[model samples]
Target: MALSLCLPLLAVLLQPAASLYNCSSQYERTPDNSDIIVECGTHTITLEINLCTAQWAGFNASNLALNGNHNNTQCQGSVDDSVDPPIIRYQLPVNNSQDNPCRQSLQIVDEAPDPSGPFSSFSSIQSVIITGYVDTPRSDVGLISYSTDLYYHFSCRYPLEYLINNTEIVASSVSVATSENNGTFIDTLKMGVYNDSDHIYPLVVPSTGLELRTRIFVEVKAVNLTGNFHLLLDHCFATPTPYNMSQSEQHNFFTGCSVEDRTTMTNNGLSTVARFNFEAFRFVQHRDRAKSSIYLHCILRLCEPTNCQVLLSSCNARRKRSLSPFGEETNDSATVSVGPLYTAREDVPNAAAYSNNVAPGKDDVDVAGLVVGMVFGSAAAALLVLGGWFVLKKYYWVGGRSQAFE
Candidate 1:
């Protein structure tokens, strides 16, 4: 009886330990008689078997699936091709969701030639799943549409982090147009972002003095804004001819020629649209020139509503005076004023005379005529004053003699 009890104890000790995981597998055959099998468990793996040679190719960690309701996090994965039948390993965080995590589905395509001979053809596609525990957070904003008059349009959705209530979003665009052939020709304009797609303008060609203007528009929408929020645009300026030359040379060539504007929006939600306008001018010498293109770089930002006011005040306080083409001093605020280049006249005496008359340069004839008129008028006034004084003296003398006789 003691011997029997010892035998039972030995059997219990010799029994194998329980497995940490279990695996499930499925298989399918290709038309060419190759077998493709997919297996899933704690680790997903796939295998392709050649029926003729009994050889096999395999892949591990091919796809991953994650639970839908998991905390937002970013995960990284890398492919190890150095090993036979390459594998992709995902480094998931330890705190990721255990049940129903997000997953990656992989499609494996076999394009390898048949080992039997070149005369035979065989191909197959197999899909495998590997569970992962990562979550992608929803974006706070989306870029609906961005269109150009040149018929180029780009639109997409991008995530905005740290978005909060009662905040402001601002977009400032500064586009500089530079000549591709020569570095001298350039023009830049800035304005409050807008969505007016019908505005057609001109950009000046520095070489030929021709106008060539292109407008830029920007629209912004708040994904899910709440409370008292605002959308503002500020501090937008463009350097049209930012030539590759020295700073002084560029300043002299441009001569403070620029356009600027500011706009604000107080509405809530995605209805708030802020549009920006920019006109670019590049100088190309050839009249029937080859195709030329303009490059524009812009920046868009978001901040608190109170921050917008502070920025606006700072910009205003730093304002400087700029000279216009007409030699008049104007306020260099973030505003643009468009006006006629020259005054029109009904009569034309002669080509040269009309040109001289309308020219902005000072005229010697006008200065001489004004001076002569002033001298003659002054002499005539002096003579009239002397005559009036003589008449008064005679009347006074006669009256004095009469008083003496009395």
Candidate 2:
């Protein structure tokens, strides 16, 4: 009985100590080239540390305007016979990678996780978009040279002051028009390339000034990307019973209790820039079934660059009616479902399965077995000594009985 009890005790005692040495680390960077490194150690080890650099890529965003047409009461595009709105698409470019140049030492939690709230994480976003307009009917003289503001006006339910302030959201803007020379359609001329935040592209000429209305195409580039940090194995416990498990499991409910640091990024010193310039310019003449109304299409392209690995791209839309060629804005609303965010590369490639220092130590299972054996041996020796003492007492008692009989 003693040996059996001690064996289990030895096994339990040796198991935890053998499973030690757990840890994790992460790196984050901002647009301005600043960095934050996080590391946590579970067991003790000392040595030089090294980490590889990661890449940073460009981010993208959508205008979320109902229909690309700013059909508000202010300025409006021409009205058309058909109900379908016009089309407007935007694109943006992003950088590829980020580098990690340093390392640090840290300590991490080693105990088993609590049933609830053991880890927590967060994400930081850097995004940009382009906003511009195209006018029809060549506003200026028949020469096709027109001077006006390429206004893009739209409204959003949420405040958008920050989205509008970034210059990188607006790429280069230039005019494109077909030129006629010697009774033949010759090359094209692009001009009026200027930046105007108050509202305008400053186009000197419209495309095909002859048509009562012209189709102007403005290219808008947008970026919306993110970074995240994660932490693990922190203390977490369910609030004592009597509370509804379903409704109260949320992170907002618990107070004083903290969560594990799963994934996180710093917002300071990191800047996001969005710029767009009219990359392509074209004008279309009014055809049959076309009317005074300008078809405005607000195309939303949503991309989730998961953990900066694979990407998920989708599109949504909104519509508006421009009162002027491209001026007046409309109160129309639109929502785009970009879908769930993508997951990043969580695991490092080809990383060692176990720590190098851990290899030097003996196997945990072997050590456990040895400890169990020793515990059992001690218990057995004690039991044997007790049995022998009992036997000796019996023998002495029998001898004393015989002597009395004699």
Candidate 3:
């Protein structure tokens, strides 16, 4: 009996692992499968498995994706025949973007360092999770959609920010994954100038010369951010030269207040796009220059979607009632500086022209017309009265003379 058992075990070990697959259903237990192989690299996760295993289970490896979220990821297939049973390999890139192309999830975990903890280990770790799914759809089950979708999730984790030794692991090709970068958060936030209040037409310089009181529509947007963050404008001001705030700074708006009441704005804390408009103006100290450039700098904050609106409302309310200690405000703010906004006091309406074309909605009583009408009416009334008196006198005098003649 012992000899027979030993012979059977040797035969089983010699057999190809692919032919021994005993998949219970479409739901594959990938991690437990001795045939499936995985290697976690610094920026990539690669997986290889027997194609026959997937084929026999009525699932296509090409159709399987990292997260089952089709928009975020797609699988490409390649075959290797060096071994007895052919294997399919997928190189999954660990990436972060508007669409997490690999559909990797992220987590931050705190860890207590062990006594033998290496210097390279961190007290807290951030990890990227990679998951793949093999699903089988049964059409016989009337439109219940995925009613028979048999799938199981298989995943691996790499605590990011830790250095890795690439020499230990070998690969045929090394495709670099786009790592999530918070370093250039400022670069991703863009500020722009527009001509129309609706932000339709762009404000072109030289062609559309900056004149005093020219409405300049401005917009700041999150261009490459995948997370939802509301942008809040703490203050926006213009200085004479680029980045020299020590020079005369002309403030357009501050803490939600339009300083001169000459600005129009949308809700800053409710959208990723923060927008406002102020008339083109010259720096006070640089007003004498033939042409000067205005540097616009804005102090802004990016807040979580949950707290932005309420926080903005509270701060603005305080600002409206009275000035607060501006420096003591919350700290997660970023500053953006846009320079060389060539502004020359051109196309300025002279005082005389301005007075002549006074805007409507003013009490403009015409004094000259009133005086002319009054004088003409009085003179006509007096003339009529004098004529009536003369007529009466003539009548009386004529009658007396007739009596005397008689």
Candidate 4:
């Protein structure tokens, strides 16, 4: 009986030495299998078999770093192998003003690819917005033209289609001689979510996850001699085809995606400064669904002066690859007065002409106050100098007449 009790205690002690911490090591168990084993000195313990099978079954990270070891990351690649055509839309700056080509600029608000919430999708048409301001009464203004290259991060798995027979990634090209033209282009790359039955799509790693950035170059020019023209630009997320766009839906997808100039020319030619403030949102309908709209609360109004020179003429243009998670603000208003105008010494310069056509009686009080202050300051300074000179004369002269004062 004592021997049996000692045997049980010895077994317990041996068990701990054989499998104390229960940790495993990576070791090949078979031709297609692996095993994790634990060892303590001469004792061997089988901890687990095929432990990482589940993780590698899907695109999973070996660890949290997503190093492609487990093949868990979605593939990153282009949407197609060819370039799509360009689309252009125009809104004149002023009614009845001579039409000019509209200018455009593209700004990428997000680099993450596809399913940018409900407000974004996987189409080249979904990536650009067209917005501009109208010139007022005097309509001679420049034609606005916009062109940009879409920069993308290439995934070995899902390479984007190129422009010329799969030779490049430039989308369609467009040019408008004037802003009166209108056209539409829509192309979709059925990402994992929007894939149609036509093409064999590959698994794509999210472009955002890779932290890629894209930009569009835009230019706005003065085509004519119009100076009082104010130009603004904005964008709307392209409506997904086969998807009905409602009034609310239109408002939803374009959330916070507008920009405008912040100053204007008043009737008197003085520039009225403007401020641009905006907000953006991700509008949803089905809560978990991947389709929604973006909305931009855009107001292009005048603001207070920010600098000495008033706003003459302002224009804003932007092109972005990513949807605006939040819209942008631009201070494009310029000084319109052509020359300096004087209203009782107040230099009121015209932003457009820089000429002085001062309004009478407006700045007279200020000028008079300035003059009074200057006169008082000059008198005080003169008195001080005179007093100092007299004191110096007395101190240097010993005998009033000062002939060496001996």
TM-score of each: 0.23, 0.17, 0.43, 0.16
Native-vs-model 2 lDDT? 0.23
What value of lDDT does candidate 3 attain over all alpha carbons? 0.52
Instruction: Output the number of the TM-score-best candidate.
Output: 3
* Regions more than 4 Å wrong, model 1: 1-85, 88-235, 242-274, 278-297, 302-406
Task: Give per-residue lDDT, candidate 2, residue 178.
Answer: 13
Per-residue lDDT over 92-202 for candidate 4, one digit per residue giving the tens place of the 0 to 100 score: 222122332322222212233334322233232111222222111222355652322111111011111111110011222233112122211111110011111221332
Give the alpha carbon lDDT tens digit for every residue of 1-406 in model 1. 9999999897776442111112112221111222222222111222222221111111112121123322423222244445433333433221212431433332222233233421122121111112222222223365553311111011111111111111111323222212221110001122223225542323222333323443434333333332123333322222222222122211111111223432222321222233444443442422244323332222222223564455344433443423221111111111121211111112234444445566433566777889999999999999999999999999999999999999
- By lDDT, the candidates rank as 3, 1, 4, 2
For candidate 2, write residues 1-406 as lDDT tens digits. 9999999999997654323222122322222212111111111111111111111111111112112333432223222213222112221111112321111111111222123321111111112221222222224556664333222221111101111101111232222121210010001101111234322554223232213322222222222322211111111122212122253422211111121133121110122211122212111222222221121111111122331122111101112211111111111111111111111112225644367534324567667889999999999999999999999999999999999988
* Candidate 1 global TM-score: 0.23
Clashes of 2: 74
Q: Deviation in angstroms for 61 in model 1?
A: 4.6
lDDT of each: 0.29, 0.23, 0.52, 0.25
Of the candidates numbered 2 and 4, which has the greater TM-score value? 2
Q: Which ten residues in a row have the lowest lDDT in candidate 1?
A: 149-158
lDDT value, residue 18 of candidate 3: 31
TM-score ranking from best candidate downward: 3, 1, 2, 4
Q: Which stretches of candidate 4 lie over 4 Å from their true place?
A: 1-174, 177-228, 232-248, 252-279, 290-406
Which candidate gets the maximum lDDT versus the true structure?
3
